[model samples]
Target: MVEMTGIVDVAARAGVSVATVSRALRGLPGVSDATREQIRQIAAELGYVASPSAAALPTGRTGAVAVVSPVATTGWYFNAVCEGAQEVLAANGFDVLRYDLSEVETNRRRVFDTQLLRKRVDALLLTSLPLTPEEVEALHAMNRPVMVVGPIVSGLPSVRIDDVEVGRMATEHLVGLGHREIAFAGGDPDDQLGFPVSPDRRIGYAEVLREVGVEPDPALTVPAKFTVEAGVAAFAELWARDVRPTALFAASDEVAMGAMHEARRHGVRIPEDLSVVGVDDHDMSWLFGLTTVAQDVRAEGRIAAGTLLEALRSGIAGETTVTTVPTELIVRSSTRPAGQSAS
Candidate 1:
C-alpha cells in the first residue's frame, strides 16, 4: 500500500519548518505570499493534502471564494469571467462557489439576506448583480473582502469596461461610414435585473449622434434583451417601420448576428441594403462576419479575482480599488459606407 505524503515531507521539500508549512497551508497570517505559494507548490508536488478541519481551526477561513452573478453561467460573458476567476483561485489552493441567482426571486433574496451571513466563503465576487442600498449595506456588514465585476458598487472594489464609451465607438463607426439613419438594438435602461449597461451605452450612442449633427430618433431605438432572439424581434420591429434605418448598432454580437439573420431572411443584404455593428466580439462573431467593439470579459474576471486575493493576503482594506478594462472597435465585411456597393 502506498503511504500518503505528509506535512513533514512538504516542509522538507520546501526547505521550511513544519510550523511554517502549517501556517502557510492554513492561510494564516505571518507568512509572506511568496513563501506561502512555494510551500503550496511543494505540498502539491509531494501529494500532500491538509486536513480541512485542522486547517480551519487556526485561520477560521474556509479557503473558498463565492462568486455571485445576476444571471446563469450559460452566457459567453458570464462563463468566461467565471472560468478566468476559477483558474486563478484554483491555482492558489482555493475553491470557487458560484451563486447564480437568475432563475428564482426567492433564491436571490435568500442568498442576499440570509445565506451570505452564514460566512461560508472567505471572500465575495459580485458580477453584474445589481444591489439595493440595503443589500450593499448587508454585504458590507459581513466584513468580508468583496470585489465587483461590471457595475460599480459603492464601498467595493470593481473591474469593468466603460460601457458608454463602447456605445459611442459602435455608433461612431457607423456614422463614419456616412450612415445618417441609424438604429440601436439593446435592453431597457431600467431592466428588472438592474443592469445599467444598456442605459450607459444608449447615452453614448445618443451623444455621438448629436455630435455628428444627426437628430436622435426615439422611434429608431428598440429595446430588447442582450440575446439573439431578442435582437431578431427588435430588428423586426425596426424593419416594419415606415422609414427603415440604413444602419444598426446592437448592444451585443449575439444581437447583431440575430438581426443579420433576420434581415437576410427578409431579402435585405448585409452592408448593401443595411449595415450592422455590435459590442462584445462574441465567440461566433467571426463566423457571422460581425463588426463589433470588443471587451475582454475573461481578463476582467481574472483581474477582479486577483484583486480580491491581494486584499486577502495583505489584510488591508485601505481604499476601494477600481480597474477599467478598455475596448476596441473591429471593422469587418459586415459594415460599409452608406449607399455603397457590397463587395
Candidate 2:
C-alpha cells in the first residue's frame, strides 16, 4: 500500500481545491465525472479514505441527515422520493437516518419533538407530511437546515408539483371529452399526517366542474386510502349509489386500476361505458392502459436532497423557496371522446 496520507495530502496531489477533492471523493454534485474519477484514483493510490468523524469536526456536524416520511418502503411516490434522496445523501458521505411514520396520532406527533434528532443529524428532510403550527415551532427551535417535499409551509424550502393543477388537468381531460357526468375518487382528507396532496387535487377537480356549469356532487365523491384495494372499495361505493358517471377522475393510478378492475367485474367496458384518468403514471399504468397525469416524482426527491445539501452548505435554513415541478397529461386507451362507442 502507498504511504497512508491525510485528506489535505490527497488534495495537494489532486491539483484541485480541498472542497473539490472533498466533493469528488464523496460523490457529491458540482464536480465533473472525469474529475471525480481522477480524484478517486489518486486517493486510492495514496491510500486515502474519508473519515466521517474527522470531517464533521470542523463544522460540529454529525455528518448525518434525518429523513422523516410516511413509511419510505411503500407508496410509489414516497418510496421513489426516498430512493432519490438516499442516493444523493449516501453518495455525499452523509448517513441517512430514516424515521417511518404511521397514521397513529402518537407516532405522527413524535416526529415533531426532535428531541433525538438534534444530537444525530446535520439536516432534515420531511417528505409529503404537513406540520401543525406547534410542530412548525419545533422545527424552528431545532434551528437546522430543513427541506420539505410537499405543500408549502411558511418559512421553509419545499419541492413539489402543483397537486391542485394535477386535479384540474385530469378533470379537464374528462370534461373536454363531453362527459358532464363525472366522479372523483380521492384519499381520505382526515389522514393523520395531514398531507395536502389529495385534498388539493380534489379542489382542482371541483374547480373544473364548476367552471363548466356542472355543480360538484357530494354523492359522487369517494374518499379512501391511495391504494388499489381502496380504489376497488371506492368503485363499490359508486356501484351502491347506482350512479352512472361517464367519466371518473381517480386521485392515483392505483385507485384507478382498482376501480377499473371492479368496473370490469361488472361487465363495464373501458372507454365504452366509462372514461377514467388518474394521477401519477405508476410503473404498472401502461400495462393497464390507464391514462394519467404524470409527474417526475423521483426528480422531486433528487431536487429535495440537492436543496438540503445547498441549505446545509449555505447555512441558511430559513429559506422559503418553494420549487414546483411540472406535470403532464398522458393519454392512453383508457379514455375516448364521450358517446364514441367502441366498434
Candidate 3:
C-alpha cells in the first residue's frame, strides 16, 4: 500500500521550500518552469494526490468543479459536453464531480435546494438544463461562479448557439434547394420545462416557409420528444396525412434518424421523394448520409468549462456573460430537389 502524505512530503522530496512546492503544485505561474516540472515529477513519483479541501482551508479554493446535468446516459449532446468539460478541467489541474440529476420531482428539488453541492465544489458547469427564475436565484445566491452551457438564462454566465438561427438556416437550406412544401418535426412547445427554445425553432421554420411564399400548414408540423423514435413516429403521422410535405426539417439529428428509418422502412426514397435536414450533426448522421445544421456541442462544453474556471479564478459569480457560438450547414446526401427522390 502506498503511504498517503501531504504537501510536506512532496516539498521534502522535491528539495524545495513548502511555499515553493505549494505554488508549483497549485499551478500558480510565478515559479520557474523547470522548478515546477521538478516538483510535479517528484509529486507524481510519490503518487501524491493533493486534497483540494485541505488546500481550500487555507486558500478558500477547492480546485474541484461540479457538473449538474439532466441526463448523462443519453444524448450525444451531453456526452460531447462531458468530453469537452473533462478535457478543459483536466488541463487546468481541477477535478470534475458529476451529479446525474434525479428526474423524480422530489429528488430534483432536494438536489437543487439542499446543501448537497454547497461548499464541496468551487464552481459549477450546468449543461443544457433549463433553470427556472427561482432556481437561477438559488444558484446566484451561492456566491460561487457558474457557467451554463446551452440556453441563455438571466443572471448566469452562459455559452449557446442561436437555436432560432439553427432552425432558420435549415429552413433556408431547403428553400434554396427549391423546396417549398417543408415540414417541421419537433417537441411540444408547452414542454414540462416551459422553455421556449423548441417553439422558437418551430417559429424559425415557419418564418422561412413564409418568406418563400408557402403558407404554414399545421398538418405538416409534427411534435414529438427529441428522440429517434419520436422522429419516426412524428414522420409516420405526417406521412399518413392526405397531403404530405416534400421535405422535412427535424429539430435534432436523432429525430432525423428516426424519420429516415421510417421513410426507408416504407420504401420511400430520400431526397427524391422526400428531402430531409436536421440539427446537431450527431455521430450517426454521417453513416445515414444526413444533411444537417452543425453546432459545436463539444466546443460549447469546453468553452463553458473555461468560462466557469475563469469566473472561479476571478471570484465573481452571476456575472451573466452571454456567449453565442456559431453554426454551419454540412451538405450531405439526405437533401436534394423536392421531387427528386434518393438515387
In model 1, the runs with Cα more than 4 Å from the true position are 1-47, 114-118, 189-194, 341-343
TM-score of each: 0.85, 0.83, 0.88
lDDT (tens digit, per residue) of candidate 1 on 1-343: 5786778889988899999998998788999999999998888777789765566667778888888876673387778788889989999888898888877577678777635533678788888777777888887877778888987777778998898998899999999999989999997545764678878888899999999998899999998777888888888888787558889999889889889998888888998988999888888898888899998888888998898898888988636877889999999889999978545
Over 1-343, each residue of candidate 2 has an lDDT whose tens digit, in order, gives 7555878888889888889999998778999999899989999998887776787677668889988887543478778777889999888877888888876477676777777677678888888776777787888788888888877877778988899999999999998999888999997756765668888999999999999999999989999668888889999999899998888999999899999999989888898999999988988899999999998778888898888888888877656889999999999999989987664
lDDT of each: 0.84, 0.86, 0.83
Whose lDDT is greatest here?
2
Question: Order the candidates by lDDT, highest first — what do you get?
Answer: 2, 1, 3
Q: After superposition, how far is residue 33 of candidate 2 from its true place, in Å?
A: 23
Provide the lDDT at 203 for model 1.
86
lDDT value, residue 72 of candidate 2: 44
Error of 1 at 155 (Å): 3.1
Positional deviation of residue 313's Cα in model 3 after best superposition, in angstroms: 1.5
Report the Cα lDDT for candidate 1: 0.84
